[model samples]
Target: MSDDRRLKVLSAIVTDYVRTREPVGSRALVERYRLGVSPATIRNDMATLEDEGYIHQPHTSAGRVPTEKGYRRFVDEVARIKPLSAPERAAINALLSGAVDLEQVVARTVRALAQLTGQLAVVEYPSLRRTTLRHLELVALGPTRLLMVIITDTGRVEQRTVGLSGRGPDGLVDPAVLERLRLRLNTALVGRRAVEVVPVLAALAEQAPADERAVLAAVTDELIAALRPDAEERIVVAGTANLARSLDFTAIGTLLDAVEEQVVLLRLFTSEDAAHRDDADDTGTTVRIGSEIHEDALAEASVVSAAYGPGDAVAHLGVIGPTRMDYPATMAAVRAVARYLSRFLTGTEGSTPG
Candidate 1:
C-alpha cells in the first residue's frame, strides 16, 4: 500500500477512536469516511497499519485502536489545531479581563482553559530566575524601618522589610539619602534578571557614603533574599474532576497525586526532550501523548503545554487529559490562553494591579 493512502487510513482510525472512545473496524472506516476505496482495500490498509504497529486490536475479533506512535504521527501529520470561534474569543476576553493582579490573572487563566477544553488545567507561576526586573521601590515606614518592593516584568511583586540604624536626631531616615539610593538602585537593577540584581545592589552599597552605607547594605541584603529562587516552583491547577470522568479509576489516583506534587508537575513541563518542538509556530506549544511523558503515573495521559512570557519561556501553562483527547481543539485552547497570558503580563492586555 502507498504511504500516503496508509497514513490517510490511520488518520481516520485515530479520529473515529477519539470521538467514540471505541476501536475502529475496517467496515466502520469504510462506512464513516469517504476513502474512495473498497472495504477489501480498507481492510488491507488496516492489516498493513497493524503490521506497522500503528494500530492494535484490544480483544479477539474487535476493531483496532491507535497506539502512542499512531497518535504522535496523527498530531504531527494530520491534526490541524482548530481556531477559536468569535464567540469563544469574546468569552475568553470577558472572563480574563477582570483580573487585577498576577495571582488573579493566573487563577482566571487556568479556569478559562479548563472550561474551554474540558480537561484539567495547570499554570506555572513566573520564575524569578527567568523574569527581568520591571521596577523597585523603597519607602520609610518608621524611624528604623524601611519597606523594599520588587516588581518583575511578568507583574509578580515581592516585598521585604529592612531595619535601619544611624538615624538622625529625630530618629528618621534622611529623605535626601533615601531618594538618592532609590534612584541609583532603579537605574542599576531595572531590566536586569532577578538573579543578577543582587550583586549589583551589593556593589552599589559599597560605593555609598558612610552615613547611608548601613541602610543601603541592609536593604541590599533583604532584596537579595527576596529575589532568591525557591527550591521548588509553584503551579496552579483546576478542573481535576474532568480527569475523573475521562480516565480509568485505577489511573486517576496516581495522576492526581502527580498533579498535587508541584515538583513532579514542574518536571513534567521542563522535561526538555519530552516537548514536541513544532518549528511551524513560534508560540512553543507542545503536545506529549501517553508514554511520551516520562512520568510513570502520567503514562496514560496527554499534556498540552505552551510558554507564556516575553522572549524565551518564563513559565508554562497547559491541560492534562486522557491520551484519546481532541488534539486540535485542546492545542488551540492552550495556545490561545498562553497568548492572552503573555499579553496580560506585558501590559498589552488589561490594566495591571497597583
Candidate 2:
C-alpha cells in the first residue's frame, strides 16, 4: 500500500482506539471505518506502522494501540483543532460575561476550561514582578501602630502592619495624614514595578517622621516579599476531581505528585528563570502529547497551554488530560477560553470590572 493509504489506516485506528479506549485490530478497523481497504491490507499497514514504532500491542490477545510517537504524528498532521461550536462559544461568553473582577475571571476561566475539556486545569496569575503599582493605602492603628496596603495594576493585593516608635491615639492620625503619606509614596513609585519599591523606601526616611518612618520601612519590606520572583503565585489548578474518573491510578498518582512539586509545573509553563518567553504567542495555544512533555509522569498525558498578558509580563493557563483526549474539541475549548482570559486580564476586549 502507498504511504498515504498507510497514514489513513493509522488515522482510523487511532480515532477508534481513542473513542473506545481499547486496542484496535485491522479487522475492527475495516469493519468500523470506511477506509476503502480490506482487513488483510490494513493488517499489513498496521504492521508497517508498528515497525516504525508508532503503535504497540499490549498483550497477546489484544490489538494495537497508538504509541507516543503515533499520538504526536496524529496531533501534528491528521488532527484539525476545530473551532468552538456556536453553543459552546455562547456558553463561554455567558459564563464570563458577568465577571466582577480579575479574580472572578480567573476562577471562572479555570472552571469553564475544566468542564469543557473534562480535564485538570491550571491557570497562572500574573507574576508580581511584572505588575506596576496602582495605588497605596496607610492607616494609623494608634500613635504606635500603622497599617500599609499596596494594590498592583494587575490586581494583586499586598499589605503589612507595623508598630511605630512613639505612642499616641489612633484617631489623631487621620485620613489627611494617611493621604499625605500615600501621595509621597505614590509620587516616588506609582506606575513603577513592585520590585522597585525598596529604593524609594530609603528616600522616604529623610522626609517622614521617626514613628511614621519606621512604619514605611516595614511597608517596603512587605512589598518586597509580595513581589519577589519566587512568590507562591505561579499557577492555580482546578478540576482535580475530573482526573479521578478518567485517568488510571498509576498515571493519576504520578500527575498528582508532579502537581505538588510546583517547580515542575513552573518549568512546564514558564522558562527556566520563570519568565514568560518571547516565542510563546499570546493568542495561540501550545499542545504537548506523550513524550513531547518533558517529565515521565506526563508521558501518557497531553497538555494544552496558552499565555496571556499586557506587553512583557504575562500568565499561563493550561489543561492536562489523557493522551486519548478528544484533541480537536479540547484544543478549541482551550484556545477560546485562553483568548477570553487574555481579554479579561488586560482589559482589551471585555467590559471593565464594576
Candidate 3:
C-alpha cells in the first residue's frame, strides 16, 4: 500500500475513534473521512495496518482502533500543538494573575492545567538541592529554645524550632548574637549544598561560649532536618474532580484515591538515568503515551511533565491526563506554565508564596 494512503487511513481511524471513543469500521471510514477509495481498498489498507500492529479490533465483528504504536506515530507526525484560544488565554491569565507568591502561582498553574485538559494535574516544587542559600536566620526564642530559618535561592523558606535541655544566658544571647551567628553560617554555607553544611556544624558549636553550646547544637540539628531532600520533593496536586467526571469512570475508580495518584505521578516523573543524555542538569518537559511507562494502570494515561530551575538545577512540573486528552492544547499549557514557574522559583520575578 502507498505510504500516503496508509497515513490517510491511520489519521481517519485515530480522529474518528478519539471523537466517538469507539472503533472505526471500513464503512464508517469511507462514509465520514471519504478517502476516495472503495470499501475493499480501505479494508486492504486496514488489514495491512493491523498486520503492522498499528491498529487492532476488539473482535472479528468490531471496528479498528489505533494501537499504542499508532498513537505514538500520530503524536509525532499528525498532532499540531497550538496556543490556547483567546478566551482560554484570558481565563489562564486571570487565574494566574492574582498569585501572591511562587507557591500560590504553582498551585494555580496546576489547577489551570487540569481544568484546561480535564485530567489530573501535578506540579512539583523546585528541588532544594539545586538551590543556593539566600539567607540563614537564627532566632533565640527562649533560654533553651532556638529557631533556624533557611531561605533558598528559589525563595523557599523553611524554619525549624529546636529545644535544648540546658538553658543559656538569655539577655546576653539576643537578636544581635543570633545575627552574628547567622552571618557566620551564611558565609560558610551560602552557595553550598545543605548537606555540605554538616562539616561546619562542629565549628559553629565551638564558636559559642560554653554556656550556649547545647543551644547551638539544637539549632544545627534543626537546620539539617530542614535541608534534607525528602523534605524537598513534596508535590502539590489539584483538579482531581476531573478524574471522577471521566466517561471511563470504572477503569479509573480504583485509582482515584490521593495515595494512588501520588504513586502514579512519582513513577511517571522519575526517569531512568540512562534515558537522559546531554546536560543532565538541564530542566525539560516530557510527554509519554500509553504503554510507554510500563505500567498497566497508566496504560491509558498520557503524562505531560517539565523540569524547572536554573539551567543547572533540575526539577519537575506538569500534568497527567487520559490518552484521549487534547494533546496539542495540554502540551501548550503545560509548557507555558512550566516556563513561568521556573522563572518564579529562580527569583527572576518579585513573587514568592506566603
The numbered model that scores best in lDDT is: 1
Deviation of model 3 at 54, angstroms: 1.8
Reference-based TM-score of each model: 0.87, 0.83, 0.82
- Write down the TM-score for model 2: 0.83
* Cα RMSD to the true fold for all candidates: 3.7, 4.0, 4.2
* lDDT preference between candidates 2 and 3, better one: 2
lDDT of 2 by residue, 174-278 (tens): 555567667888888888885566677777877797546645666666667777776666577888887778743356877788877766677777552232243
TM-score of 3: 0.82
Better of 1 and 2 by lDDT: 1
Winning model by TM-score: 1
Candidate 2 Cα misplacement greater than 4 A, ranges: 1-4, 36-38, 142-145, 162-177, 195-212, 247-249, 257-283, 296-299, 348-354
Ranking by lDDT: 1, 2, 3
Question: Per-residue error at 226 for model 3, in Å?
Answer: 2.8
Q: What is candidate 1's lDDT per residue for 128-178, written digit by digit as tens?
A: 778888888999999989998888888987777899976766789988888
**Worst window of 10 by summed lDDT in candidate 3:** 272-281
Instruction: Name the Cα RMSD for model 2.
Output: 4.0
